[model samples]
Target: MRKILLLPFIFLPVILFAQGQHTLMDTLRAQLEIVFKADQQYRLPLEGMAKKYGWNSHQVDSLYEGMSIRDSIDLGIVTHILDTYGWIGTDSIGPSGSTTLWVVIQHADPDVQKKYLPMMRTAVAQGRAHANELAYLEDRVALEEGRKQTYGTQFQLNKKTNKYIIAPIEDEPNVDRRRAAIGLEPLEDYARDAGIAYKLPASPPAKPAQGPDKNP
Candidate 1:
């Protein structure tokens, strides 16, 4: 993608140089900032609510319904930008702006995540996107596809324990090696942040029921 591409929003005038000096990049960046905040606005509150009231509470469910609406709107915006811009990255937009694109997609429905996975892989290959972010996406896509995660980045909240547990991972023992290649901390270290006391078993877990490539 070009460093600066004209973005003509359907709701607004053709983006161009103006008296206010609002260029296409400026509008795109502004949209990204709005998306970033909206993406978190419901989520941050939900996290606090989950901690205080528990996941199954009516309060948590109500907040989640609202968050789901915001997520759908954000997904539409992000997909539009991606379709128009093709994964433009930190060079064209700042880091936070670029991240907003990935963040929205990461939180999107599984089909959306799967559709954009290859594009993000290309972005990472071109150094437009972060490898670590790609790693997270890869793990999510794998899990969504009923395959074991590669980098062990995905976790599930165990309702019984009210604690998080790392999702099923392929090649459990060497997950850290894959993680290190992409600059993520070891799986155990990452699990700790979720309050999980996890360790790689001495023996590798049974090879994931044969499936598509899980290697990152």
Candidate 2:
């Protein structure tokens, strides 16, 4: 599945935007942004060239972008930063940087995500990270297995239409309430941005508590 940088303000903004004094998460977010953007910017070009020619096709032009070993190396650095410096609060890194962590972790190995999610989730509770960040992570972990996602962060690319389709999520009946609690806008907004059609329930069910995932 092709994953676009679906978390709003999550990709290019990290490069153009500035944060408060370089706290641990702020610095880590910047590094992670660089690597993740590289992956996004180049992965497609690399794949196109690979398909047209072949793997390790040295004849390929430099303009074709592809993921490199450097990505893994940098992910290790960010992981170390998270593990060592501990969770930085939303007060410190703000929403953009916190979302940057979500993007970074999204690209990391599943094992790495599993290891750091609890810490990241705690940061969300402490107001270090956005609750939306934890939600995005939960959705990603579930989407990896084709299970129902909790926060509706996952999207799938339609090859025939060349469009992005919002993936399945759990508790569709109460998705918006869950979304609002975590600082996310309505599901329709997200789906709209990706050019997907979304129809809300005629009326939402009872609201869930305004909390992050129960056990992300």
Candidate 3:
């Protein structure tokens, strides 16, 4: 009977730990999805973002493949145009050293091509914009990760006090730090604002005094 009763105690903690970890992972992934949406809006490539996150190319490709139907269509249009018409060749350069090939090749019936050219140009411009936006997103992701690590360390230290049940830290700094830095607050208050319980570390212990120096 005692063994069966004790078994519940052991399993209970294991279950709770697993549940907490799952919640934290889900929250992190939700934040990542927001970042991914911003990238999609700007037509950012996922290759570099994947590499920055240490994900394999196959994983990155899978993510892009799984995008929503609307996002997939936009990406498809941009990629196809770049593949078909984006080339620049030395042979097409004019005597003045400017390449007229793109303009000439794109010329169809004056009314039709003129209407489409601006849309094509916008696609090209968005593609270039994507490169810059992806770079910014990569930096933002890295910064968020570093913030989580810092907050985790602080949380662990604060755990010594029973007053606080430290919650999983977020990746973003303004959110994580501002919440964690709130001085001497209860766990529920932090959880309400920051999506997690948090507490600052208790003050450090006083250093022991050095013994009087022995005469050399």
Candidate 4:
């Protein structure tokens, strides 16, 4: 979607001697924060503009080009961290740090998202990651794979209508319950922020799932 360049970038020398892994994690956390801020700088401003003037195709394209560059760079760092240390969870890097990892992966291509989905699931089970972020990533991946999303977190801008709408969701009427389980606001509520007046299906609500979706 949308993806900062903190000059004096992430190339700082990492001292891992007697300081141990904690120091290494702190450095990584700082790097993650830099990447997270960069990820937002372009997209947030563009989102504000879209809300004010509606989506301008040229502006959206320009913003995405910038975001894609940052996203690729961020993804490289995230992939290296994951490869070297496995998933750095909240316990090791704190909530914001863990979220930065998820954010990069979520913005990655579908193949990259699929590659790391299982590890993220385990991170969630261990309480090292936020379920809400997992829900968003899960919905994104599912939509890319031609499947119905679970949390209704993925939306598409209908070029014709010039509006945002939730992507297809499984058991649509019960999506709110599924979202609630993972700490996401209701779909309708989330949509409103994007200027979408979302409405649930007329069908009766289905029984809630035992937990978040079991599929990967």
**Alpha carbon deviation, residue 28, candidate 2 (Å):** 5.9
Model 4 agreement with the true structure over 1-216: per-residue lDDT tens digits: 121354324433344343667788889989999999999978889876676666766777778789889988999999999988888889879899999999889888889999999999999999999999999889888988899999888888788987777888998988888889888887788888867888888777668769777798
- Give the clashing pairs for model 1: none
For residues 113-182, could you state the per-residue lDDT of candidate 2 as single tens digits?
8888888878877778777768878887787766899878778887898777777778786789999987
lDDT of 2 at 117: 86
Clashing residue pairs, candidate 4?
3-39, 4-38, 4-39
TM-scores, in order shown? 0.79, 0.62, 0.21, 0.79
Query: Model 2, stretches more than 4 Å misplaced?
Result: 1-65, 68-70, 92-96, 157-163, 202-216
- Give the Å shift of residue 180 in candidate 3: 46
TM-score of 2: 0.62
- In terms of lDDT, model 1 sits at 0.86
What total of clashing residue pairs does each candidate reach?
0, 3, 0, 3
RMSD of each: 10.3, 16.2, 28.2, 12.9
Candidate 3: tens digits of C-alpha lDDT, residues 82-201: 355442122222211111222221222234333434444453354322222222222233333453322332332245554433434444333334334533234346454644554445
Worst 10 residues of 2 by lDDT: 59-68
Candidate 3 to truth, TM? 0.21
